[model samples]
Target: MHDVIGLVLAAGAGRRLRPYTDELPKALIPVDGDTTILDIALANLAASDLREVAVVVGYKSNAVEERREALERRHGVRLTLVHNDKAEVWNNAYSLWTAREVMSEGALLVNGDTVHPVSVEQTLLQYRQQEGSEDIVLALDTAKVLAEEEMKVVTDERGHMRRITKLMDPSEASGEYIGATLIEGAAVPALAEALQATFERDPQLYYEDGYQELVNRGGTVGTAPIAAGTSWVEVDDHRDLERARTIACRY
Candidate 1:
C-alpha cells in the first residue's frame, strides 16, 4: 500500500448527534469502549499497510490535533491533519476537495465515522491488486438492506458504477457504499474535477456526488463487497453509536 495514502474525512460536526458532537468532531466520538471512530480508522489503515494517513479535521480541530501524537505512536503511521475552515457550512465535497494535494498521490478514502474491522480495507486493497483494476474501487455492502439515508450505488453488469446517490430508489440500488474506496493516481484529476463541480453546483453535496460526477465524465469506479457476516456501521446518531459499540467489539 506504499503508493496508496490513507485519506480520512473527519471534519463533520454531526449535528444529528447533538450533545455528543458539541465538543468533538464525529471522528472522535467513541464507538467501541473508549476507542474513538478516528482511532478505529487509523488502526485499520495501519493494519492494511497504509502507513501515510491524512486526516481532514474541522469542528474542534484542536481536539483532534491534541490526540495526533498519541495516535501516531500507537498506530505507527505518519499523520497529516488537513484543516477545513469551511467545514461548518460546506459539505464533504468541499472537505474532500481541500485535500487535493494529499490525494494526488492516490488514496484510500474512508469516512472517519465508519466503524469496521480491518477487513473492509483489506477487501478493497485485495480487489484492486488481484483484479488489476484502475480508478476508484468503493467498498459496497451488497448484502445489506438499503434505506433512503444510505449512500446507494447502481452498477453496470461488469460492476462499473452507473449511478451513486441516496435519491435512488432502494430497488434500483446495486449496493450500499460503506465509505471505503481505493482511488488511483491516474483518476485523481477527474475525481478532483468532479469534486469541484459538485461543490460548485451545491455546497451541501456529498463526496459521493463527486463520484457520480466522475461517472458522468466517463471515469471508471468499481465496487468490492465485504465478506459475508462481517458487521460494520457508520455512526451518525445515538442509536448508530450503540450499534457501533456492539459490532466494534466483534471486530
Candidate 2:
C-alpha cells in the first residue's frame, strides 16, 4: 500500500453532548484526566502507522486548531487542519468535502470525537488487503446494544452493507456504524458526485446519508466487524465522556 492519508472529521457542533460542549468543541473535550478526545484519536492513528493526518475543524475552530498543532509538536507527527465554514448548517458530509484535496488516494477517514481500542489499526489493515475492489470499508461495532438515537447497519452474510438506518428501532437493528471508513482514490470522484447531489438537495444531510447513497448506487461498501473485545466510544454527551475517561485511564 502507498502512503495513506488520514482524514479526521471534527466539525460537528455535537448538540447532543450538551453543557459539556458549551465551551469547547467535542474533539477538544477532555475524555481522560487530561487527554482530550482528539489527542487519543491521533495517538491511536499514529500507533497504527496511519500518518499524514488532516483534521477538519468547526465550532470553536481556533481552539481545535491550536490544540492540534500543539499535539503534533509533541507527538512528532504533522497534522493539517481544514476549516469547515458550513459546520453549523451542514453535517459531516461537508466536513469530508472540506478535506477532499488533503488526501490524494489510499486514505482513511475517521470521526474526531470517537475513541476505539488499538484494534482500529487492524480494521484499516483489513481494508488495505482488499484495496481497489471495494469503494468503502466501514467499521462496525457488532456487540453494541442499539439505542434509538444511534445509527444502525444491516449487512448481508458476506459483510456487505445492505442498508444503513438512523435512529433505528433497537429491537430490529443488527449493529452500529462506528464513524470510521476507508475509501480508495478511485471512489473519490463518484463519492464526490453523490455528495454534491446530496448537498444540492439538502446541504444538512448526515455523512451516513452519503455512504448510504453509495450503497444505493451499487458501490461496493464493505463492513469490518470489530469483535466484542475491541473498545470504541463516541464522546457526545457528559455520560459518554465519563465512560471514555474510564476506558482511557485504564488503557
Local accuracy of candidate 2 as per-residue lDDT tens digits, 21-83 = 777788877877668778877777787777778888988888876576678875567788889
How far is each candidate from the true structure, as Cα RMSD in Å? 1.2, 1.9
Please write out the lDDT profile of model 1 over residues 48-120, one tens digit for every residue: 8989999999889999999999999989999999999999999999999999888887999999899988998
TM per prediction: 0.97, 0.92
Model 1 C-alpha RMSD to native: 1.2
Show how many residue pairs clash in every candidate, following the order shown. Answer: 0, 0
lDDT of 1 at 142: 94
Model 2 Cα shift for residue 117 (angstroms):
1.6
